[model samples]
Target: MSTSIKQTASSTTNPTTTPAAMPVKTVVITGASSGFGRLACKAFQKAGWNVAATMRSPERENELNTLRNVQLFPLDVCDRQSIESTITSVMETFGRIDCLINNAGYGAFGFLEEASEEEIMQQMNTNFLGVINTTQAVLPYMRKQKEGSIINVTSLAGLMGMPMLSLYSASKFAVEGLTESLSHELAEFGIRVHLIEPGAFKTGFSSAYSFNEGQATPELNRERGVYKKFLDNMLAEPPKPFGYGDPQDVASLMLKIAQTPKSPLRNVIGKDGKSLMLTQKLLGKKRLLKVIGNAAMPKLSA
Candidate 1:
């Protein structure tokens, strides 16, 4: 089941002993079926790196499968066995994993009160625990290599909470903290752990948005009515002030972070993301909250 591709040197001398035959660096990206993950697979491959694109259903994928140095593997981050097996398979195929991108997560929109127990658990497990599982599975290989990078795709929500994304924000916030702490812990091992916080983008994530459908109890229904406008606005297209970004930009940044040895621990991508983070840094929390409040719910803010 190995999909390893070895490069051959063209020199008359022995190819095995030639410098040109050095093994290509490989990156394992989860959620590579579409969005940033898919683009990253292409970016790394185009840059002459081996790519192990792992999705929940590799059988359903067609694009990356057609690429030269890219291989697809079935991976479900929520399942520990799947993560371990996928990592093992990737290691066997690529022979070396220089980078790992934990990017397989979905958004859970709606008010916190409207979120059912199952919805909450799924959000936490997929966004937070999934990162942990995948990271743990890849750490041993990266540690042995003694020089690797781990780029985690968190969101702008991780930086600041917004309306209708309470659970999603919480999950991302958890990853933000985990990544920061893990970066410090893994610094000595030569494994650089970084976080990429992207703002709204025109990606499959918008279409894959998961709106929490809690039980239709009388109280919950009434609550939904009160928050309907805010929820709708949040679900709608990004406001004029904060338009969606190009997904390729995020993918490019991922590739850069993987290649750079001293990349920052946290990278905020997209114009909107950078602006919001800048505002928070300069204007303080109170002003930042007002800006977010006005954007998310003008009527409620007024």
Candidate 2:
């Protein structure tokens, strides 16, 4: 199921010997059913790259399937064996994976103390460990090619923690660290490690966030009540730039990062996200914490 890259007209005497154009680069994007992943598939395809738009359920994909140079594959980042299988299929189909987008992660929202052990572990496994597993599986191919890029879609939560997103933040923070360390380690192999720290995007993530349903126990329920107001207040506030953002922006940023030769290891995706990160760097830890805490939960002053 290989998707053919778009070609331009050529006027060489010997087409076989002269090479019509640069070899088509293939990108393997996890979680391509929706959000940034979906848009990135279109963006890459528009840029003349063959896109392996891998999702957990390819049957549900409608948009990317209509596009040229995009093939949908079944992939689950949390499942190591499945990841390996998907990569193998992609390699067999396309012959190379020039870019690997680790974008198959979800958010787990709620008080950390109230979340069940299962919830916590699932969040970590899907978000942090999933990236680790997928990257490990793809590194062999990327290494063999000796020229590939691994772009991780982290979040603003990875940069700064906020109320009720403890587990989500923790998982993203872990990815941020992993990307940083791997950048140093994989640099020699020409494998550029990049992390996309997206801000509040108008995606289904909020509605799709996994909640701690197991926290209904009397003791945990009472504990949840204690933190409910803070969490609620934080959740109620409208996101910067007038609520959620368009996923296309993040997709564009990802395309830009992939095209750039010396892109930064950590790339923030939105205006607000960049502002928040810049302020944190200038304000230092204590001051930044104070600012973010106050902003996240405005009722804290009361």
Candidate 3:
């Protein structure tokens, strides 16, 4: 990708000029090509905030390119240089960035044993370490401004364990911990760290979901056969407690997080996610595990 910044369409007034037309707060959203990232860009722009919609492929951008005061920047959270350059462009274009939404992670599915070493590393790098790097890159600017919000888009998997999503869960769990800790640390700098725990959303994320091909050896193939049956059985249940949701809801929640003063450190996006969390709290870990395990997975022989 080119290092040059892909800027947004001009609003009624020039976003460059200040304090004349409308006061515009700016937000930088990663993974802005599709799903929640795309929707949030539109939502924020609609709400009168200048949006820095950063994506890996700004060349392929469509709808956001038409919106006013919504600049497109090339950013790969895994690349420190890419991140730094994007922030610089954002600063140069928008004058200030009031929010950073770390939403550039893909789902890594299947058992831990099935995943390759590279897969595991990429999973953590994109989801956890990427968040760290992006946060670090943006902190100096936020500190200089004396106020900003850093929203980490996590999942229900971050809060609870699931059968096939071991590695995905682990990465999100790390993000949850990081966000919680940063909330306290950054509060002194007038910055807030928040996590948006969205449940399963029909965001085309599954298209990017990486499944470990565990068919390398005969033994592994057999293991995968059994795991497949378990996964099939689990998915057989239609209308899951946490059924798939519209990406727009998640986008709206993100806007709320960015705008709301004194928002909670962690915000679960859907009713199903909130319900699942409440169930865990009420049932306790042991009982909740047993209930979910029996309900979601096939029984394996001892």
lDDT of each: 0.87, 0.83, 0.85
lDDT of 1 by residue, 1-302 (tens): 12232333443357566444467999999989999999999999999999999998999987899999999999999899999998999989989999999999999977676678999999999999999999999899889988899999999899888777899999999999999999999989999999999988988676687878774467556556656655666557664676889999999999999999989999999898888878889999788988787767535323
TM-score of each: 0.89, 0.87, 0.87
lDDT of 2 by residue, 204-256 (tens): 77557776756566755654665565555645665755477778988888888
Q: Better model by TM-score, 1 or 2? A: 1
Return the clash pairs for model 1, or none: none
Give the lDDT of residue 133 in candidate 1: 97
Using lDDT, give the best candidate's number: 1
lDDT of 2 at 107: 85
lDDT of 1 at 137: 94
- Ranking, lDDT, top scorer first: 1, 3, 2
Q: Residue 192's C-alpha lDDT in candidate 1?
A: 97
- Winner of 1 and 3 under TM-score: 1
Highest TM-score against the true fold, candidate: 1
User: Could you give me the TM-score of model 1 versus the true structure?
Assistant: 0.89
